[model samples]
Target: MNPKKPPVPVPLLMVIGIVAISFSSIFIKWSSAPVSVQGMYRLLFTSLLMLPFARPYSGAACALRLKDWLLLGASGVMLALHFLLWMGSLNYTSVASSTMIMALEPLFIMLGAYILYKERNSASAILGMAIAIFGVVFIGWGDIGLSAENLKGDMLSVGGTVAVAAHLLIGQKLVARMPSYLYSLIVFISAAIVFAVYNLVTSTPFFNYPAREWGIFVLLAVVPTVFGHILFNWLLQYASATTVSMNILGEPVGASILAFLLLGEQLSGLQWAGGVLVMAGLGVYLYSGRRKALKLQDSLPNAS
Candidate 1:
């Protein structure tokens, strides 16, 4: 008889996912296609790749109510906007600046939760938000001294982060009632449709890209969308949310290293200082938020 197989290593897979996602900026920077076109093809390819696995959750998708469908559409639109803005940022700013600004995503999500759901935050979380904002401002100020174009890129990156936070907020509502795979599939398809319509209206040529660009699209789909995000989500079943959040904090460091190695990117003193501040703030923010959540969970009458 064959020997029994060993269990999968969740920690190793999480590291793989982080590494895969760290390539996102590098691939986007390499593509010369219009941001919209790239976003469209990436989502299209991602949706196609996910279709096979999402089949098990098709029943859940089909059962979505009208409100759920509408919210899903909104979520998709936000995702498309995020891709457009974030990718567009690459044209103007350094990867270090862009990724550092994006490191504020958890803060944005926290603020969104407070605004929309009345979720209160801890004092430490607020302090973390302030520190992170200061870091962003520091980076932005440095960019302004460098060139207005760089500043524009930083702003666009901020907008993109906000858009993604909105996407997550919408997902938080629906994921409780449906499979995450189904939620992700519907959102990806919706974003693809949105991009398809935008491209058609703008008369953007879809198939005019060279082979290299096509490969980047496929890599974006397979590496980040499938291996990075999907794998991370799968690992969530085993890891604490705190562990996952902490791991995500490593992305900027990984991406900056990759950018330096692959694209000959370098950070200045100001950028380095600001980057450190940003990561520090994000770390505090995530830690406090997770602690609060665990406390709340434990306080409940039916505490696990």
Candidate 2:
């Protein structure tokens, strides 16, 4: 008899992560609180929940240079900006549009890397960029004709995309030095502090939120912020990053479906088309980068 097949952990974890993270937008929509209140507390609660676990790895993080810490801090602030804008966008647009915009993150990361790290872009990369830009323009154009509020929401979502792409790219630099756990902890703490101070000055009234809103806050912390991210991070050890990234493209589908079933949200034809184009462009962009990397690796002579 053949031995029992081993369990597939990477894809399993990825599916679970996708399902868990799909609730982030749903939870945010369920809340009636202001953006500042939701954004600050989400980070604050996630940070507090992660603190105990991060302690074990904090010592390992000390080996990181000051530049690494600075980068992590910047990433944290960028994360705050993403939450501020993306979470707010849900109020103005359908879940499908917002989640579809989130998938454009890879394209934004390409731009951020070009500007911040001065990374060279391939011809395919440029082509992919053009396509993605056109898709966004198409989406926004349709939104403008339909409702200016939608156009505003799309723009805000795009802004949030840029922020998150910057956060991921910056964190990429630091993760080479320290563990992801510690890096996540520092960034979460820094983001929480930034949001907290902003909220305090703005008087966002974090404590007076209803109990149901508080439960949503906790769900945001545990589901997407902690569990989903941690699962993806862990799966990285078993699967190629490329595979993991491709799987992340499914997030919009999962989220959109949940929105449809649970929130009774629907998307326009333009939004659906834009989502397809954005995802196609991103897939091409990532594939091109991989090809370039492979070609470079092949050109390097074997070591003596």
Candidate 3:
């Protein structure tokens, strides 16, 4: 018999990982701190918390190429900006709208991969992305007409999505050349420094937050930033980027459910339908991409 296949399906692991990541938005919304402070502390504590676990310097004596270092730094900066925009969006928009719009990052990733890396995009992948975009449009329609605040939030959410896609593309390039933990450490540290400086320059009062807000901030750092992000990165070792992207479809579902339960946010019929379309599109994209990856792997020569 062929050697036993890996126990867990990659797609399933990715779904679980993304589900954990989905909790992030809810925590951000629940925290009483300002968005910039929330972003700042989340990055700060996550970097600090992960240091003991990653112990990245154990292997840092082997210097990274300048290009690799630049890529890693860029990824961190992009991530910082992504959080700044995404968390800020929550302050102005419905969590549902922000989550749904951010779900489009996968589509942006696909487009970026095709354009920048010349990765082949199958027709099915294009179709799936288009369907998902349509779904996002449908979800945003009501909010589009509602108020300027919602519209501004929607724009910020979209900007965050673009930044996240850029992060993924950069990550795909960098992770291949460095340890995942090391790359994560570099990115987190860089982001933390940037946020810290921004917090200081703006004279944001960090220590003035109420105990409850601080508690939530600490929980946010531990749960979503540490547990969720590290798990997602670890899963990348076993799963293709496209597979992970597919799993991200669950984020909106998880976030929406949490919002409804915790904040009593009601979802309209059109929004639910749109969510289904997004899920279906992601499903199709993953299926097609995984098959392609398997084929490519099979065609490669095996090491003796």
Candidate 4:
């Protein structure tokens, strides 16, 4: 018998995903529209772009039971909440602070994975996570605001992190049932609906935005939604959600660099130090994970 081939280039795709998602903060910062409106169109455009490709997977939806549909819908709502909260946070807090808060996602994800799926990381991986988180804190330590508005933004960011974690945890079981694209399509559509409803309730204008804002929306959908998140969703078929979240830790570093270049935001020596620590931690995490995977693979023959 032959060994099984991998379905996709997991590492390459992960890099692409991380890089793509790093732009999210930049695009969100450029937009002057309401957060709900941004999210509505981001997901809406994502759904429309995915529709043609996703139609082939339509039959997969029929095979899903009500529980699965409910899970998908719930995932969407959680995702919507995540965008609304996180994007809203940017208005009141610094990008570094918001992204730092978002870095807490892996810890949230690990806890949820263990609770829901009984998944656990190796000791080394956990240590790496700790190191990376410390780096993130160090980077954002000076930038964290003490003002009431900043506090509100930090709280909102925390909510966004929890929402995203919930979204991933809810989808953990369902991602295995259907194709990744199909799964993403349904979830995106559900999120779009939630955003749409929220916009309607708030009486926010749907079409008053200038061309630049519209471009931002489209870029958000294309870069982050398509190349970033959808790739991670695809990876869910092969890797644990915890692994994906670990990869997401790089987003702050990427975003920070982008901020310096594109937005002309200044980076301090402390930020650079923190960036190095974050990379080192991620290296350790990936090394541990890879070693464990190799050990598991080696043991398969003995078990057989």
Task: Please identify which of the two predictions, 2 or 3, would achieve the higher TM-score against the true structure.
Answer: 3
**What is the C-alpha local distance difference test score of each model?**
0.74, 0.70, 0.75, 0.87
Query: Best candidate per lDDT, number?
Result: 4
Candidate 4 residue-wise lDDT, 1-304, digit = tens: 1123356666777778889999999999888999899999999999999888776787898899999999999999999999999999999987888888999999999999998889989899999999999999877887886999999999999999999999888776787778878888999999999998998888999997899999999999999999988888877777778877877688888988898898887778888888888888988998887787778779989996
Cα RMSD of all models vs. native, in order, equals: 5.5, 5.7, 3.3, 2.1
TM per model? 0.82, 0.77, 0.89, 0.96
Query: Which clashing pairs does model 1 show?
Result: none
What candidate 4 gets wrong by more than 4 Å, as runs, is: 1-8
Q: How well is each residue in 1-304 modelled by candidate 1, as lDDT tens digits? A: 0112216754567568768888999999998999889899999999998888776787787788999999999989998998889889989997767876776676777667677767666789778767766665555344443678987998998898888777777776676567667777788889989999999999999897899999999999988878776665444444322234334445666677788799998655665566577667766776785576567556866754
The worst-scoring run of ten residues by lDDT in candidate 4 lies at 1-10
**Model 3: residues with Cα > 4 Å off, grouped in runs:** 1-8, 238-243, 301-304
How far off is residue 209 in model 1, in Å?
1.8
lDDT of 4: 0.87
At residue 37, what lDDT does model 4 achieve? 93
Please write out the lDDT profile of model 3 over residues 201-273, one tens digit for every residue.
Answer: 9998878778888888888888777666666665555554444555556677678768888888887777777
Give candidate 1's whole-model lDDT. 0.74
Deviating ranges (above 4 Å) for candidate 1 = 1-18, 129-146, 229-250, 273-279, 301-304
Q: Give the lDDT of residue 44 in candidate 3.
A: 81
Model 2 TM-score on a 0 to 1 scale: 0.77
Candidate scoring better on TM-score of 3 and 4: 4
In the range 65-127, model 2's lDDT, one tens digit per residue, is 777778878988998998899988988887777776776665666566667667667788667
